[model samples]
Target: MVECGAKHLIYVSRSAGKSKDDENFLHELQVHGCRTQTFAEDVADSSLIKKVVQNAAKPIAGVIQMSMILKVQGTWNLHNAIPGKDLDFFVLFSSLSGILGQIGQVNYAAANTFLKAFVQYRYSLGLPASVLDISAMADIGYVSNRPSVLAQLRCAGMQMLKEPDVLDALRLAILRSLPTPSAAYETTSTMATGFHSVSNPAHLATAVATDTSILDDEETSGELLAIQIGKQLLTFMLSTESEEELDLGRAPSDMGVDFLVSIEIRNSWRQSFRSEITVLGILNAHSLKDLGKMAAKNLKEKFERRNEAMK
Candidate 1:
């Protein structure tokens, strides 16, 4: 609407429901030479949705709420929206869950994977418009039910930050972006010093306090693991320059053991912009090998029980 010399634009989302704010939003749009159209039908209903899209003015941009798990259903609805030239942009509100699968949300992961692929495909073909996927982080928003493993990782990561000055870390992230594209950036002050050794807290504390050039023989470890991970991530962005294509051949499960805990820093601008860092952490046990074994045993037992029940 901003492109077509529209001084006013009102978007009526059916998902907005019958709230008074929706009507007020329409009214606000009218003040700027725009109108609102609300559909009283389900977003997933293809037949009725097609009719709604057909009635809308030229250059329609529709927002679809889709999860990563429901691949077939989500993609089908998106595919249906592609028939019209008026459909300028299909905005999909997806989740980081698609990129980093949540433990219990396998179906969500599948759906989001499909959406990411679909968006990339559309981009590849140089379609007149674009398919945009907006993904949300797991840490942000109301996260009352976050898993214990995730909480542990966050705690570990935070503890590492305490050694470094917050301002220095922000400066480092900014310095890291000087050779890349970063629009706006923020980093915790606690990200400067690398992790200390695990054995000696006193040695770690002494290292922080005094200007000791030599390594302590007492064996000390700090939260350097998290900082190393962070620096490596920043380095990857600096190396890739954000031109790396999505590895389409890789399956969701084959991604990595630390799939969910990985952070992605993308350069989203046409020019060299600031680094946009998004973190995804998994809340599983400390040892992946042990966890996998336990999970396998549990699954085998369940299968055996089911077989006995069937007989």
Candidate 2:
């Protein structure tokens, strides 16, 4: 946030840093010429929270709440602390469970549901707010720590969301200029809500049967699907932080698509997008767009043959 003009930083943690890692962290910030304060106490502790406002180093800033059952209390504490203050953004880290109604997570879902309502409350007061109903991630955070949870999620046919995807959502939340992802539903300046992952193929089929939910134009377009496939290719090739709208004209081989990753690309897209993309095709493709278009055409033919058989 120092890059975004937030010179002074504050931390509200259960434990104050007194380790070597802490020193290194502080040193890094010092190198960047940023000031920071650590309010070494629980945000749930209203009394300690008061002291944070009273003891300001170089003024303070706005709400970005990410807690469990204490989400309501922590956010309340922050909202109570800074009343009538203009905040650039108030981001709440929520979960898909709350929206999709997960079983055996009554309290967990309730806490997240409060974040949904809280954003609306902020809107009522003419304050900026954004809540992300984030999905299960493959790496980092709670899911990565547990194999069983990850297995269960996979068993449920839920596609795992990656860190870059969450970052993209955050960017959309903070900066409205970026176009919302095609799958985003019920989104506005204050909120971008929904999890396409949890809505399994079976569920989608049911929805289609009931005429309750229909696939949009983006989902049906071969060109758009090609772009999506291209992004998946780029994601596998490069690091998480990258341009989703990267130049499609660039050759895949030039972008580090070796023999092994080419095989992986073919296999993965074969199962997901149901394309006949070969390892050789990926390596020999003139451009990423060309590969995507080839995959899209293969998928189209597959769907056509299936339709003919059904008829």
Per-residue CA lDDT of candidate 1, range 1-311, in tens? 33234552323234543778677866766777765566665556677657766676654543434333334564566466656333444444444455546678787667755665555444444332122222222343223235664465455442222212332222222222111112333211111122332222232233222212111111111122222223333344454423133232332223342433332322211011111223321223333232223323333344445546755
Task: In candidate 2, list every pair of residues with a backbone clash.
Answer: none
Residue 192 in model 2: shift from native, Å? 5.6
Please list the residue runs of candidate 1 whose C-alpha ends up more than 4 Å from where it truly belongs after superposition.
Answer: 1-17, 57-75, 81-87, 121-311
Top model number, TM-score: 2
lDDT of 2 by residue, 50-135 (tens): 88878877555465676755788998887777653456667788887777768899888888888878776766666667787887
Per-candidate Cα lDDT values, in order, are 0.37, 0.64
Worst 10 residues of 1 by lDDT: 213-222
- Tell how far residue 261 is off in model 1, in angstroms: 33
Model 2 lowest lDDT segment of ten: 209-218
